[model samples]
Target: MLEKKLHSLSLNQIQIEDMFWKEYMELVRNHVIPYQWEALNDRIKEAEPSYCIQNFRVAAKLEEGSFQGMVFQDSDVYKWLEAVAYSLMWHPDEKLEQTADETIDLIAAAQQPDGYLDTYYIINGLEKRFTNLMDHHELYCLGHMVEAAVAYYKATGKRKFLDVAIAYADCAAEHLGTEEGKIPGYPGHEVAEMALVALYEVTGEERHLNLAKYFIDQRGQEPLFFNEECKKNDNKCFWDDTYMQKQYYQAGKPVREQEKAEGHAVRAVYLYSGMAEVASATEDAELFKVCEKIWDNIVKKQMYVTGAIGATEHGEAFSFDYDLPNDTVYAETCAAIGLIFFARRMFEITKDSKYTDIMERALFNGVISGMSLDGKNFFYVNPLEVNPEACEKDYFKRHVKPVRQKWFGCACCPPNVARLLSSIGGYAFECSEDAIYMNLFVGGQIEAALNGKKNRFHVETQYPWEGTVKIKVENQEDSSFTYAVRIPGWCQNYELTINGVKPEYYVEKGYAILNHVWKNGDEILLKMDMPVTLVEANPRVREDIGKVAVMRGPVVYCLEEIDNQDQLQEIYLEENPVFTETFEKDLLKGVVTLKTQGKRLSEKNWGEETLYRPYRGRTYEKQELTFIPYYAWTNRGIGEMTVWVRI
Candidate 1:
């Protein structure tokens, strides 16, 4: 039953454990956790007079809040919940669980009785609820709250917060759902459907599920949100209906007809993920097919080299296929987190290892990159390239920028990562009955019931940071079972062994099966070399054709301007850069840094270009530059930075 349930993520015992606790969860625990907390602290501590104030950055000092405001509502509770649930994943720790409980309790207290919730504007006043769903993100906030409660309940078996989630959900259902007396609309955001699905999973409550379905179905149908906005503003609202029409949001068509990704990057992906869930639950093959089709379009054509999605800076949305611009890549962290959610759901729907493969990709580079190395600062938008100078010179620079921030005025990434990592365990494995399937590898022990008896499995490994792994069974002296392991698309030549005896079938890049009768003291080990890989963006991704992003194991690396003083255009790599693995004594641990020899002009004389002058490509002299994991940028002082430095 377990094998069939997780038929797709059938990873070896060692790989599953290593990826889970070592690479994936540790990145969440050590790095992502701290940054999210810092953002939350910024939100709690920096509110002006009565407003819950937050800026796009610490020193940018500009307070611009919108849907990002709603994201923080979830951040307040989600990350703590993730940490709490994670404590049990590798090994149980009492302190982690307590922290999780405390955070959830605070979230419940933060909500008011009428179900009008949102910490940002609510800190200023509750009158703002439902008034500005177009931008204030009230429903979006409620959506996140529902998600947190369901997660907390699942992770800790406590429903105190779940009740709060339900109350907020009830408010949404009662107040805004039906148009009998009020306006007819859906969240300008897309979290409610996803959260409602989670609530349904936890309580088996149909109202919650029906409401979730309602949100998905209501979208793109009648009285468009923009139309409502226009009616509210008497035509002064910022929306351009023409833009909305071209966008993925069909406000005119039912969800079953909406095909392309559109609107806000984060919202679009989240909505798609929720739709995937709805389709999976209802067994709506048509909807599920659309979900898979969108998934293919994203991974094959829309995804970033860092596993990030959503290309266009306008609306921070996904544009045409291969329209990837490194420096201008919006690559919103919430969108990447959404990509993980969407990918995971698709994996669940199809039980495909490829989904897990992409899941691991998003988790390591695209996902973790949102948080700074010290864990305090964050990048709401994880661009593949950064031009510190252009960031200052160009005011239109929403997508291209440098350095991490204390908080975002539109700060959704911080809390999204928090909740995602805190609940990272759910993405690691699945359980049904008899057969046990290992999805990821991490050193830990898990207790489960098999054949009506209690049993334990002790797994140990060095994962993302390294590839070696080991696994051992505990408690049960003898038994018969099957452990299906995933073969990564990246792994070229791999080997698996049991008790030093190699398995007859080779561990190919896409598959490896280990089916056998098991006993106590049995062991398995997997060893693979994560060769230095230079990945060029697809040919159609014109911006990245000549450039390459360095990736080893699970982390993707980039060269920032601070690490190289010369302007990016002046530098050019003569050959593939040399791989020099190094460890930052304190910050990012057990890492590889790729170094390169490049050329730069000594003269600082070349300036402007004639309107139609023929440009010349010239360069000289060799210099040293290092590429650290994209997740580790801006930790040092911010300067001119570019992930896609020339060459």
Candidate 2:
């Protein structure tokens, strides 16, 4: 039934396929794409490395023994390139993919006869095979490349990148596996497994899938991890922290028992999501249940009000459940990106609202929260609250302070957002040809062939700000189709009209179905009320109780100390305060400011009394404060900022 009108495509399709990936691709076409193409052309011109080994026909051979001192940073670049390439696939940027094709060939040529591929090993030095996990990020790098290649192949029906990915995956299958004579396949970090599965989709080659499966299956098996301390000589060790030093690169417990998300948050979620996809593809019910368990535990207790996950600064890792302390929360940008991946997979697995709910929340508030509104600067850590004044006091703790930053060393969000946006159309709808569901409201045009007929839809809306969606539908011929639209959990009323006439589909649960005969130029208008909604985290999240966060149409709003008289903690938005906002077109494009009366608690009272009473009567005069979108904070010269404030 989903095949008829709307597919789950509108879901991720708007964000990943349309908005994110497409924007990123354009960004590339504008800046990075040209640079990459030039770089590839240069490489082809120079014939890098000098014929170390003969590779695929499309590839240029690398010279023998040129890159000896490099710390495998070159290896990681391939992954980024691969991501770039695949991002070009569904988004269809030929020039970039062609450059990627050349790079893929270069990678293939670097491979050893037995299937090993590493320029350092084959060209420059020797025998550094899985010898350094902590510093290398080798497997993690390859995994991304493989994934990018596979995605590119699937999207474009092209195999240039795929061949290189297969060759590398084949090499891993040969040597780095759990079976005897094979090295156990667990990345020092855990992304390659997922990447392999993504790679496997193109090959449909069982070995690649099995190799990916083996990495996941072999996790927590026996040797938690192959300790490379001796190899790093203990001094200048990759994982310097003693606690991290003692950790098992791969855990030894059954995957289900591996409940608390361990390791780096990005690695953990990427690995888990890959495992979920494998489970679905393989029909492994146990893995699916395990995924659900982990998902439930995360959203219920660990995720931030912004839908950001991961809570500790130690490894940018997950802390205990419900231990989401806002000031100290290390909600990494990559973790939120990973959450999107995990949540989307969960959406496909169960077709449930909960997963998409998190997906939507993260996509708008947390994930995009990582990127600046202008599409450049990104925040590596998206903390909920910050006392900019306190940051001067506790310097280290100040890292948790929420602010928009230029870029991170491990800049994953930019490309991740890019690829997600480019492929967003796919997320909007999914179908086997019977029914369609509108998951997200983003203004866009789509043309899809349905049931031997061509159907097109042009959705016009100012969504994520206003809740109105008007869809103009066109078909080759008059026909009957069923369209399902999601009724948000937050909205009090859902209204729909067909051909300017008021109509209700008899909503149940959260899905409203409109089944009807359609004609060319027919219109469907749906409006969801967008009132300023105050949300509170569950009691388990002790950091959020007694504090309220305001969200208007997916964008979370916050109050900066700049806009308030006292520090953020001492201020509160008066109940039933008159609020007014206007879009300031100049000098910031668009500005949404909220003016509300707030009474600041007296800090002087505490200073005067030697004996401190924890509770005191509300002091200080009521002050008017202007609240802006949380994404807009810190631009006004780093002052105390509060995302969630006392009611």
Candidate 3:
């Protein structure tokens, strides 16, 4: 219901030189990006065979071999290029840029006449194209292609890759949609919608925007396009009455009619994010309302405490409302990254603080949990609770891995994390003609244009661990603008001072706004009180009754078996537990570990190890407990981890 529109800063405009995020970004550039490139080329002998580059060569007729990876193997190359593009934006490396350019050349060679570029279809057969649109991922690959092309153009102002992407998009426009002699089809996996929007933003092509809008509109119509396409090709109906449902692809009904979060979590969020973009561009109030309703459904009822979206491991989809199980959870890393995409789009349309809050929450905890400190290992499924034996022995908990793996054949999360972290500066702040919104309080420098004049500002902070932030305006003395600092949803008490003088200010939608004439060396200091608070889920969430998760600032803290004793379930919170915080400079690459007093319940005091035993009074022994950031849990040889403990 909010009215203000958002305009995110350009990737080059905001530079992150932060103590925390800069390290992660460097890790992506130095380790993850190069590592993923090696993986795509099938050079990593220890990792799974991706066959990404080989497939391109086969499709291009430069080599003779069969495609050996997933139908979407081509996306791996595209995602890596996108990550490299974002990486080169601020940390320009000629070697990385050359590598990406060469990869793009291989991709360009793989394109078929009339501008079709999917390696699966190019090598497999163009006759097979669009026939299996339900699962072939043709549009999905094109989506990544367009996204990478846009980033590359923005990063290096290179038109070669963008030209390739536009050619393919034009082909899509000619083939798909509801026009006469055109097939009415949409993507099995989304991303094309938003990617097309990005293309339109760069090229100012009305067809690209219209094509994206057409895809959104044609989906889930009376005759579902997916069903019709499947029936035409003798493929089984995607919405089989017996097993899989159309909701699995978020195509059960028209997007506006679909009120609840359903289907594959990543697909659903990507599709919704695209819908938000189209709604924003078209200024469609009804479509905007759909976004708001769906956002409410996801964030209010379905989202996990750690900001992960999906609930069930089956199909990696959401379960029933308030059915957020902690132990058997499938909070896919890709889905959390998709949530950030969705939230950012929602924020662009409504300029709501709630959307930014979710983005920050997911970034600091669930999303980053996908990557390890070393930046080589990654988790595809980020579960809230971990039990090593249960993860190994229990079939229901099979998707939850106790430790990050070296690689996967799919290889989605590692590169997805890399792309997000590399381009993270775009998410930190947004600016208008005369106002600046500090979205995330990370140490950075922003160079932007306001009122036809260039302005610069420098921010210094030890955020997420320490609560104090100092920002200095570096504009000319006569320049004036409104500065807005986001007061995080978790913060309860804070103080702000300008030029060392406290001033009365008004908070609008979680942002403390100060309108002032900026001058060089004008300093603003913000102090937020950091306290260990207990967070409880809504009463509707049956899994988290009479339990609390420890939180300080934006980070969610968890108890791991490495710190606590074995048998994690026996741990209980003390009635009036006192928590003390200390900075461990050498632990987990320097984090603030929280220490508290708790009790370990005596499991042996029970009468017997029976399923149904009447509980007598149980004995408890005091134990000192240590909690680390949830994102840093499995870095030290994972065993057991729990966020919500007995209170």
Candidate 4:
């Protein structure tokens, strides 16, 4: 039997002061949140209009305008509000809280008498609501709304937003399910399944839990509900393409029978996340096994070196096994974020460090790459390789942006980044009945009760750049509990000592288990060797067969056109190259850059117009290649960037 499931430390319980994460948290608090608020209200000049706020007003009949933006645009505001809720937990601001409250009030006003919300249906026509469950994202919007409401209520102790969420949930419960007169349909886009689970956790509503389960159980069942609905609706879909097929929605087969991770990348992970959560809550071992199988498939075969997924741009989705492309990849930012969500929940259920490893990988590399250092511009597609000319000229690589844009018309990735970064404290720590799991090496102060005894800890570290973590325990009463510190998968050499002496420790699934009676001022030190590593992909990955990716700790390194000359593809690393680490405080918001001696395939002997130049035994000149953290690329003007270089 599984032990009691672990619970993440609440956002209020952990205060992040990490030199690495604090910058991101502060960026979300100060710049990203404010900028998104303006964008949502359609106030950002020279950018695409959001009209999210105006849609709510129009739905409430407080203003006269048709619904604008994507049908799921409401989620952008909810995601921003969720980020604000997390930010307010650590950085209190009266003005921001007031704005959020006002926004919640507007949301409440837009809700119908039947407790139905969603400006697209409310403003368009209430009669047509739920008519196209396979296309319209009504359920998807409600999911984000509930998530925001839960976060806000936790932050402010305000029930207004929570009440709205409960009411809308009740409305959904009344309409969707297996009972007579119910729609018996799930979201075309996922997240509702997980959001309903969140609502169930907060409200203790069995129906919410059941609704989430029903969505999961009903998905990919025989005589697919999506097909039936499509037939009923005369085959009209919001996104009419090959993506409208059942496989793209991950509804081609029953959830339990599905093996490989497939379909839209975001939807696949979002569904898997919900499955993990519901399985944990209900102790469904079968469902948990399914999650494990898919997780293995994704991390082993499908994922990129930077923890990115969705190998193809066609559906913004996963391609076949071992088909992870480099340039024409559509590794959306939200897909990586969703993978983190799944990884965290899996860790919570199983107390396994592998889950946290992937979670850390995605958090440090793929997720952060979505937002700029200043937190203004955003990238929807986080490609591992980029060439300006190819991105412009090659039709297949059109989605690959050489530079992060100020805003996007779709605009989901920015606010998603905001919420994830703001609430990062929750991801860093987890508490069980008899153990405290330190998942991510983030510098912070955390307070949690283990085995009914309160304990406070101070963690200090400069991770990703340097790996020396010092943890100090403070508690009034001497407590005996296991403190599980993760030994990151990438760290081959590490030393852990308690109070200046190495303790008797046991390794369990990648975590160094230190079971001891804790006391005040008992300090623990962890030193992980941060050596630059050259990583080569599996031979199956043809794109990276003879190439190497530079990495230090969890940060993947990339070569940009600014640091090296253009034609980044011409760069090559010698076998067993040596790298020197340099901390440049002035560059890309104080990052540790790696300098290495490598060879660049010289074009000096070739003509300027030579497109098909034969490699005459590969003439090369030795050059010092500069490698910055992959997340920091594109911050300094658009240039050629590649994570993999030929060796």
Candidate 5:
């Protein structure tokens, strides 16, 4: 049987007052957003110049400088604009709005008369445009532009940006497709497929939907459009094919025929997300099953304990199953954000709590870890283990930085984090005609329509720290609908009650289904037992075979050199150790810290001059080890950090 489709509440319809998330939202609005704007204008010192705004200005002929930065530099601006739109929904600022408006006008002015838009081609030679879709990211930039346009229009009901997106999409539809005289190539980075679907939803244009389907259907086909393009361009390949082949671009085979997740981590998830959206829109069960297979392969075999992906730094791509190494993993911040995007689309299709579970896992751990608490610094690569000396001396571990960076020449993670954090309310809840699903325990007030009646809910909780969630129902009329609350996969024991009385409920797809004719002032309380769990990886994972990771609720914990002296690799958690949890308000802007008595190999036996010792049993010294949330690590001074500890 086909499941009823679910839809997420728009950002404006939901307001978050979450103790944990509100602070992040405020950071993005007040600091991150403004900081990024300055960076875009090349105003921030000690940071790599963005040249994003200047590139757009140059393309518009408002300035005479040549194009600079990455091929997708324009995407940073679009992502920031999208974040601004979401922020304005909850916290409106006239100056910020005016700045966004002026930026949009500049972008509009940069558009070609034929509706084509891309600063790279405008500032560079137009004749060379679309010739290198395999590397140049023109379509990728278009996708982010459409997404930002949709978000801006939805937030403010302004059509200026929407019209710009419509024109560019029309231009794409005209130039690239299966139609006669049109190119048959798709985005090397796969966001356009899903962005076009979003544009279709707003514009009610069949061409947009058809274009999206065309992109998905055309990928990995015979003759490999990318190879043909390369051939046409005199066999000139911009990026080396050593690590990134057709498979690295996910164009080796038809997407449905591809079984496992492969290629650049960000591109793979973006493509999978697009496939999931198209599958849902078309009701293609076969395609959705493919999404299921790839998703399982990711979370089950290739993912980190902190919900991070991309096991290897070679290509920033997935390696074989059970190949999750700690110190050398890539786990790019953008990949985690892309994973959340994929998870949300899947949950909207099936209304399953399993999808939401992974979403929350990535949200609280991997995604937020991309940015520092102050929101001024960012991490492009999130590693489970880091050693400053190794990072400096070891070529293989060079990508694993012990501290966050202020900015990057290829600055994609910061604005991506900003947009996701700003629109997080959309991921918190989804609604259908007769049911409402609370996907995450984000404390907020959501106004959604249920059975043709407006229903308001105030969700209150201290999540990740405490698992008790109290949802107060407010409605003008009595509503008979199913309130599906997600019971996290990590939670084993939980209690659910309605207005102080236990209610009849059943579990399906990891959600506790509460069916009732709800009334105003009624309260639903869910208390999930939060215990500091010791999680062991599958034995097949060689690196983590004898190690265990610490987690409480959805937050993964790690030991930092600041808390537990250096040489984190030498520490071992005692067998059957007892952990004590304390809330430290002054630490990392407040977090729950875990402490346990553990053992460390005694180094006194070996003298500084002794390079080798006789084969004897190692001596151990008992020490108290403290663990902070994985996301909170490195916020203090730089040092060694590891998530998995020897047992």
Candidate 6:
């Protein structure tokens, strides 16, 4: 592992002023969070009943109602609170903060005297608390609560919620472990590990960190904890060969021994993130090696062009190597967000650009695709190719929804998108005492300590839309430090200059670094070559043969039925096609649309009645094709969309 120690800035210390990211942050704060709160309270009449808030009220004895929503429904509220906390870091809202604080109070009221906090098991029965650890989400809810508590504590410096979370963590630590009389059960959903680590970070409790490490180390051991838990759950094992096997939870083997990516995509990534955290915090290089192996396995073999993973719709799990299928893919939005979480932790561990490259790829594409333009609607499953009819009729494609939904009973993605977007500033840059690393080319202002001095700077750019980015140093001391900008993996040729003069620099691991002293008005202008290129899949990926996807900068473009009209199957890109970039301020929230030349099969040459024809020369007509960012396609009334086109 590279020993270049790097650290991520706190969301409280950074503000997003970039046009591209600012719009999204505002949307989450102004639209998604409020709408999600309404949905959680079951106030949105047309949306599916979340009953999330109702369950908490019932558990708190303030309302008389049975537990309604999923076992993990409490997480929805926790995630929203987390988002609200992040939003409060920059834009303070009294009512929103009041609502979140009140919600936390309700959650606190529902807690058992022993610090048990899961409402489902509390409202259902105390006896069922640890009975169904394999499928139930008791620890999962606690994990989200811990994360929210940490965010709230960091954002507001309040210890009320943090104490509640720590109490819950202490309760879990007391009940579960490798010690005798304690159940050796890890979370089936795989987040408590990371959440406990976050708690340890804030509270400096060795128990929390030790508990997180214990869970990771105990997972997938022979005579598995989950298998034993399932056996105790009335001899019911999800690994009965019919349902989701143990591998579906990544508990089939020891984490260090398992090299392949498996199980639910979200759970796998979350667990991997926790492993990375424990590896870094404990300085366990062997555990980190496992993380590296799995990272390579996912990125090199199983990842998609849009940076989405998990190919199979079944269990939303990762398939074999290079088994990525576009039309039947299951790239859940939460999974992409989880990938970002995992990738960010990896970067903290190594400061490698490869990890941040994947992080940006997922952020600009798959992760953002989860939310609609209005931010009120969300897509749980993001498929690269969409066929509206097949989504309606095909049983195998039933999970693939053609349009974004306002809400769902299992509403994970909406709040996930909200939290990620609200706290996006933290992912933009990482700084050390002597240097600052710009992981994402987002236009934002940051005030951070570098080289034992306070520094301030503003990043201005319409990135992923325009390749030219300008970094203006607003305030800095007369001291030396390194300022590294990530050169996206897609950009080949680039130019970097300081104060309109060419600067000498060296590229290291995909970052263009400029180190100097005494900078107050120093301006760095980075011009990256953003030529439209057709990206081809590896030959082993059977589904993408003879197909190419459009990419410019970090954004991947796609063809939509609304743009192409019809016969999407007949459109083909020529050997060498010229593409023109145009920014439509009114289109898809002011995005850069691509226009290219292509050929479509002539309608007069073949009738639509025949399914097949004998081998014969086909005639084609030249046509103009318009491509939009893959993430922006479904917002315009999803009809059909595809990332790969015939070459």
Best by lDDT: 5
Candidate 4 local lDDT, 428-531, one digit each (tens): 99888788899999998899988888999999988878899999998888999999999999999999999999999999999999999999999999999999
Q: By TM-score, is 1 or 3 better?
A: 3
Residue runs of model 2 more than 4 Å from their true location after superposition: 1-113, 118-126, 132-135, 154-157, 223-252, 389-395, 401-403, 501-509, 576-578, 603-616
Clash pairs (backbone) in predicted model 4: none
Error of 4 at 622 (Å): 0.9
Give one digit per residue, the lDDT tens place, for model 5 in 1-647.
23437887887788899889999999999999999999999999899999999999999999899999999999999999999999998778899999999999999999998888999999998888888888889899999999999999988899999999899989888889887999999998889999999998898888998999899989999989998998898656544456557888899889889889988899999999989888887788898899999999999998888888998888889878889999999999999999999999888887788788999999998999999999999999999999899999999999888899999999999999999999888888888899988888889899988888899999999887999999999888788899999999999999999999999999999999999999999999999999999999999999998899999999999999988899988999999999999999898999999999999988987889999978798889999999999998899888999999999
- Candidate maximizing TM-score: 5
Model 4 CA deviation exceeding 4 Å by range: 2-4, 237-244, 609-615
Distance from true position, residue 230, model 3, in Å? 2.0
TM-score to true structure, per model: 0.83, 0.83, 0.97, 0.98, 0.98, 0.98
lDDT for each residue of candidate 2 in 46-105, tens digit (9 for 90 to 100): 323212122222222432224422344343345456556445543556676666666666
Model 5 TM-score, 2 decimals: 0.98
Candidate lDDT (C-alpha), each:
0.65, 0.63, 0.88, 0.90, 0.91, 0.88
Give the worst 10-residue stretch by lDDT in candidate 4.
Answer: 235-244
lDDT of 1 by residue, 1-647 (tens): 11124422112222234433445456566665544555455533542111122311211223334333443444444534544454444445677667666666556556676755566554555565566565556677677667766655654577787887788888778876656876556777777788788788778989888888888777766656656755775544344634655244435567777666656678888888888878877767887777777778788888887889878777777778788877777888888898888877776655677887888888887888887655556677887766677777876675565777766655566666666655564566554455454556556665555545555677776666667767676765666555556667777766788888986553333446566666777777778777777777777878876776667876787776767774666666656566666655454544556776766754444546534435565447778777777777777777655656556
For model 6, the superposed segments whose C-alpha errors exceed 4 Å read 1-4, 242-244, 605-609
Clashes of each: 26, 47, 0, 0, 0, 2
Consecutive 10-residue window with the lowest summed lDDT within model 3:
235-244
Q: Which ten residues in a row have the lowest lDDT in candidate 6?
A: 235-244
Error of 1 at 347 (Å): 1.0
By TM-score, how accurate is candidate 1? Answer: 0.83
